[model samples]
Target: MSVLELARAEIRALVPYSSARMEAAGGATLLNANESAWMPFGDAGLGCHRYPDPQPAALVERLAALYGVRPAQLLVGRGSDEAIDLLVRAFCRAGEDAILVQPPTFGMYAVCAHVQNAAVVEVPLAADFTLDAGAVLAAVTPAVKLVFVCAPNNPTGAGVSLEAIDDLARRLAGRALLVVDEAYGEFADGASAATLLDRYEHLAVLRTLSKAWALAGARIGCLLADSEVVTLLRRILPPYPLPRPCVAAALEALSPAGQVAVRDRVEVVRAERARMVVGLGALPGVRAVLPSQANFLAVRFDDAGAAYRRLFQAGIVVRDVRRYPGLQDALRITVGAPEENDRVLAVLGDGA
Candidate 1:
């Protein structure tokens, strides 16, 4: 069965709102959508006077090339967060269909599910924070319409193998859509699950510019899947998703020179991540440092509350994820620039 079959029939049948920008493209003299005739005082050529394109062709084409997918198979939006919301809104039915998630993972998956009145099923990662394919498959029921896997997962920084992804996708082929969140993919060692899209029609990959690309403020991201899946999402998507300046920022960042710079920065982050792992492990209060394939490290300390207080007192900010399942004693630290990292080390050197 097609993945489209899993989507709410109401959403599939409803017509999405069509903005004036989508219907009419180019004309020097503009008079549509009730847009302002004059730009803001400090517009600086952003062209904020008009509504932006729903999916700018250039940005979509650029992202498609960058991720090794076709334009038709990609849907760019505010961020991976928006994509997640759209998926839940379209697939899961209120109080009926559900979304499966491997927890101690990204929180947004569950947040989106609850907002759409969909059930959230947990198939948590192993004690060691590794994905168990067999365990995941055993938990899937007919009610599960979506399955979320976070590659180089957030907070923990553990990654799911592409082979395992392929296996799960194959097993869940007709039953559920395997959604792999690769927000931290550029920093991980594993290749993308997008590689298996050709084989599994029900698979989707969510990628973001927020992490490695340093485009978090730009709010650019995409969902890569079968072209048919992309078409189905468009039916329910907000018509004017990308703002003009944000679109320009994305285009500039995806430029050849921008990509070169991103690669260099990514390498720096990888090196820093490795260095932090060793450095953090050597700290006095740190009990354990989990293995990571992304740009951060999850370190378990003797006293998480004390550790958090010390860092903040020293004017350093790091995520205190003690509230997350299996992370009660852990603090997540992003690998900062050299000097910034030195500050973290110097401050935590005494072990809070």
Candidate 2:
């Protein structure tokens, strides 16, 4: 049997939790699975009495429209976190299979692989924080099931080149899935990997409502992939993966009114990001300001621990990315509201 067939047979024989939604059928009387007798609290504006559509068709349609892809190409999950977990679970086999990651990138890629008992192969980005194509190509083996590239990457905040990603996809065409985690793609200057989805069947682009859309609390993320992949993932995902309230919130967040608000917020964040980069670059003990395509800037400090502590004490909660590979003594500061940015700048200026 082929490798994929062997993998599928192994997975198919493993019993997954039989969710109520999975067992229930579309019938007039729906009396199979026990649901709450009383009505749910609060006017969610959408009916919460009924279980949310297993995949939330309306949301998928709207997202497909927004991302310029077909509905069949999308899978909406709880968040990018869940998407990362699902991809690892669906593709990587325990102990035998592996996945490739670019370090100083998203932690969840490695985290999910670990949870699935999959080996993680690290391909450290170049000193300039661009894709080390040679390193990536060298790391992939037959055991590797997936390769995760975080564009406009987390912490480091640099977008990987489209040419590099395409090349990587081409190399792994039949061997592994190339997942481009575009969680921050909306903030980047170029068109997203969604535009290239048609060209590469092996390419999957992960998008989220958390960053640019300002809907972190809503907990909605989209995975754009080939329909066959989406179908397999859907079979494994939790039925009612999205709660009714979250689905409503996400739908509202993607509305025309919400889109305008998000655009305004994006502009504000982008402007703040630019301003903060310049201001932070001039601070005492500041080593270098990494160019950012995301809403946050990764700043190298002479004393990151001290700076992190000082910022924390001042009621600012920027992320300390010193633990990440190649990012020792670096702090990731998210661009906050105008006044908050000003406060952070003021605190940094004091040289504490």
Candidate 3:
């Protein structure tokens, strides 16, 4: 049987959630979806009444141009979070299929697996937050449908070696999909895994506008893979997933001017990250500040709980990554504005 045929029958037969937007037909008429035909005036001038395009064409075209890939290979979603969920549902069979994830990384991979009732197989990263190819290969099984590796990984901020990723993709060929989450790829020094899409049919890359493009509020994310894979995953995405305003905003955000702005912001963030690492490293309780290729720093403190409390009391929020394997006493701090970073440093220095 084909892989789709072998997929969960429930998913095969599953009818997805349909919205007013989904049922709308193409025409000049304005009756369907219960939206106001006219635009609201004054401050609310932008007409948000019309349902957005199901697959935003302009955004796709612009993203395709930016990533140097065909538009057919891209699927934009609410965030990488939605893409993760959709992939798991479309490929994995509940109780029978599984996904492989590397730890000291993002939690959503395991969460998505659980949501789909698929088991999660973990291959924790080495002490330096790098992949262990042998450990990963050993963990693979026939039931494993996806292998998720976050590059410039969360909590650790280190990029996975390109060779390791290529090797994993080669090893998993014909057995499972290799998903590389490159949410922070923009901050890295080299090209992204998106560049390798042409060579690997089962390889997928997840990117977000939240980190680099500074569009977290727009809720934009991109999934780039082989067109066939994108087709399969698209069947499960919400119809009219991109709102009209969001589409407009994202289109604007992907323009030449937008690209320049994003690049400038990334440079600022990278500089701020360096400043944070240096400043935080000098703190009395800090143990180590790991090298990072992304816009955040993973700081190891003498007592994570105390540092967490101190930061919280100072009105600064940082992620406590103590739960991650090999990340005990570590806190993941985002690179904020200079003033914000200084505030955090001041609080940490004051022993608060």
Candidate 4:
């Protein structure tokens, strides 16, 4: 079954908005979209006065190359949040269709589904934080339109194996779209799920510069899917999803110099993560440091409330994930710079 068939009928039949920019391009024109003739202050050679391209072509090509996908298969959005929201809105009909997600993972998947008034089916991961393929496959009903699986999952800091993801995709074939949020793919040890895109037509991968690339404030993310799916999402996306400065920022982040800089940073984070796991594990009140393939470590403390206070007192803030299922005494800590990580270790040793 093609994914397009699973999409809402209204969306399949709807006509997209045609803005002035979409109508025409590439001419020495004035008075077309009606804007100021002067460039804004602090333009920085990116021409901030003019509205950004509805779809920045060059940036699209750069990202496609970086991810090993064709340009036509990519859809750029504000962030993974927007892509998640769009997938829910485009496929799941209110009060009818549903999406599946695993608990102790990213919350945005459920939040987006709830905002769209679609049912969210929770399939909690196994006790070890690994995917229970059989349970997930058994939960796929005809009403389920999308399934979200986060790799190197948030809060827990555990990764789902590619083989498991591949098996699940085959099982859900023609039934639902399998979305792999690879937000921390760069920090992982192996290849990305994007390598499986050509094999599974219903597969989609979400990527962002917020984590490894270190551009959280820019808020740029991408959806890598089949060309048909890309075309459908393009229609529903806002006419101008990226602004001039954001486009420039993303381009620079993907450049040769930027790539080198980010790689260096990734090395630092990875090294610090190892040091943290050992350091925090030996702490008095710490129980266990869950294995992590991402930039952060999820630590289970004997008394997380007290640990949180110690870190807070030292002007260090980390995520308290006690509310997440199976993580009552866990706190997620990002692997920061050497000095910062040392500070956190020092504070935790203060016996607060």
Candidate 5:
């Protein structure tokens, strides 16, 4: 019951398309792929005109080292969103195979499944916004090709139990690929699921530089899994998925100085998150501030609409998560800079 058994048969047998860039490497004159003779104007250090490496080698090495995995075990993509889409395409056959998700979780899991015309089975999180591991394991069926778990889950901000997740992965061994979306792992107070990859051949971890690294606009994400699974994703991923500039930017972000800066920033965010929690707790009409291991906090207000308006009027923007299942009166607020967090406190306190 290997994880590969879960991948669509067609994808496993299909020979991936070989682009012009994939055929050859640098030599003298580049006449293979049609391109302008002259470089584009306003060119920075990055050779934007040339097709970047189908998979940037140096960047892959850097990320693999950072994530504590071998270079061969990673697949870099546009962002975690692209990784999510690739997983669905490779495993779930349209109208046949299915994927499971824990709702009030990341929307893209369901969105990508829908785009692939695959079935989506949702097992809602507990009222405390925690994973019901026993329930999630029971929901697995032969049709389930993928299972997405968002730890320190978005909007909810509660970190799912790692022990429970480990047990679930052990139970689902060979039945489905257990995908742990650790987008907010940097803020959490626990080890990553990547540590379990050595044991669980079916485990997949999605990480990004979007949040803690302050590179959201750069849109860099990595899918860490079994080397074989990584190769499967590569087969279907678009050639030249990353631009030259993006590769350069990510390299810089992973350097020693950049890492130190990210750590400093993370500490500031954690402090601000605490301050925001305490400040919001004192405000009237605030029902609860759910415990969070992520950088954001999910605050339940007695009147979410009024709370939203109050913040909007003050030019402070936070995610209004009322429409999400079970989050009717909640707002997900990312821990911002000191000044920004202060403004939210001032506005909300005044409203109370």
Candidate 6:
């Protein structure tokens, strides 16, 4: 079955909101939406007087080129979080359908499911925090409509191989939409799941500039899927999803020089990730440092609470991920600047 056919019938039948921007493409005089005729006093380079494009053309084309996808197959949203919410809203009917996610992964999947009043089916990752494909397939009941897999999973940093993902896609075709969230793909090794889009029409890939590109404040992200799927989600998105200033920032970040700087920084993060893993693992109070391809480490300490407080006392903030299942003694620490990383090592190393 086509992915569009899997979306809620109500969504497919509903007419999308016709915004002022969508109505007229060419107009010198702005009076359609009753927006302010004059530009603001502190007008930045990008004029905020007019509503930005629903999916800004220049930004969309730039992101599509960067991710190696056509513009028709991509949808720009607030972030990966918005894409997740939109997916759940489009595919799931409240109290009828469900979405499946692997535990110790991104929490937004289940949160969106709950918000939609849809059931959340969980298949816990293996001991090493890898995808358990068989368990996932077995857990896929008729009610499940979407499956979110975070490549190089969050909190744990274990990635699912392309081969494993291919097998899952083959098996789950026509059954449900397989969404591969590559929020940390730039830091990890190997090609993106977007490369599999042509082979599996039911697959969608999520990417963001928050991590490697260092545009977290801008909140720019893209959802790459089959052209039909992209069209379907656009029906439910806001009139103007991206702000003008954010789009300007994203475009600048995607420029050649910005990209080069991003690459250099990623390499530094990779090196620091390695250094932190070894340094943290050697601490007297530390139990283990999970190896990661992402820019962060999931570290286990003899006394996680103590370690968390110690870092805070030293003015360093690390995520306390003890509440996540199977991570009671672990804290998630992100890779920072050389001196910042040194601060982390020192705080934990000083008789920690």
Scored by TM-score, the top model is 6
Which has the better lDDT: candidate 2, or candidate 5?
5
Per-residue lDDT, model 1, residue 283, is 87
Tell me the tens digit of each residue's lDDT in model 1 across 1-352. 7788988899889877877976766788778788889998898898898788788889999999999999999999999999999899889999999999888998999999999889999998998999988889999999999999999888899988888888889899889999999999999996899888889989999999999999899999999999988988898888788889889988998999999999999999999888888888888998999999888899999998888889999999899999899999999999989888888988899654
lDDT per residue (tens digit) for residues 1-352 in model 3: 2335424566666676676656646777868677777765652644676777677778898888888889998999898999999889988988899999888789999999998899999898987888887899899998888899999888799888788788888887877888999999999877778888888888899999888988899899989998877867776887778877777788888888999999899899989988888899888989999999888898998988998998898789998889888988899988898999999899999993
Write the residue-wise lDDT of candidate 2 on 218-258 in tens digits. 89998998776677677678877898888888888899999
lDDT of 4 at 341: 92
lDDT of 1 at 31: 80
Error of 1 at 6 (Å): 1.0
Off by over 4 Å in 1: none
Once fitted onto the true fold, the runs of candidate 6 whose alpha carbons sit more than 4 angstroms away are none
Error of 6 at 211 (Å): 0.9
What are the per-residue Cα lDDT tens digits for candidate 4 across 1-352?
6779989989888899886678767788656777789887887788776777877899999999999999998999898998999899999999999999989899999998899999999999999998877888889998999999999899788887888888888888999999999999888888889999999989999999899987899989999999988888877999878888888888989999999999998998889999999999989999999999999999999999999988998799999999999999999999999999999999998873
Against the hidden true structure, what lDDT does model 1 obtain? 0.90
What are the runs in model 5 whose C-alpha is more than 4 Å off? none
Candidate 5, number of clashes? 0
What CA root-mean-square deviation does each model show from the true structure?
Answer: 1.1, 2.3, 2.6, 1.0, 1.0, 0.9
Query: What TM-score, computed on C-alpha atoms, does each candidate reach?
Result: 0.98, 0.93, 0.92, 0.98, 0.98, 0.99
Q: Give the Å error, residue 109, model 2.
A: 1.1
lDDT per residue (tens digit) for residues 174-204 in model 5 = 7999999999999988788888888898999
Q: Please report how far candidate 6 places residue 102 from its true position, in Å.
A: 0.6
Off by over 4 Å in 4: none
Consecutive 10-residue window with the lowest summed lDDT within model 1: 21-30
Pick by TM-score: 2 or 3, better one: 2
Model 5 — TM-score against the truth?
0.98
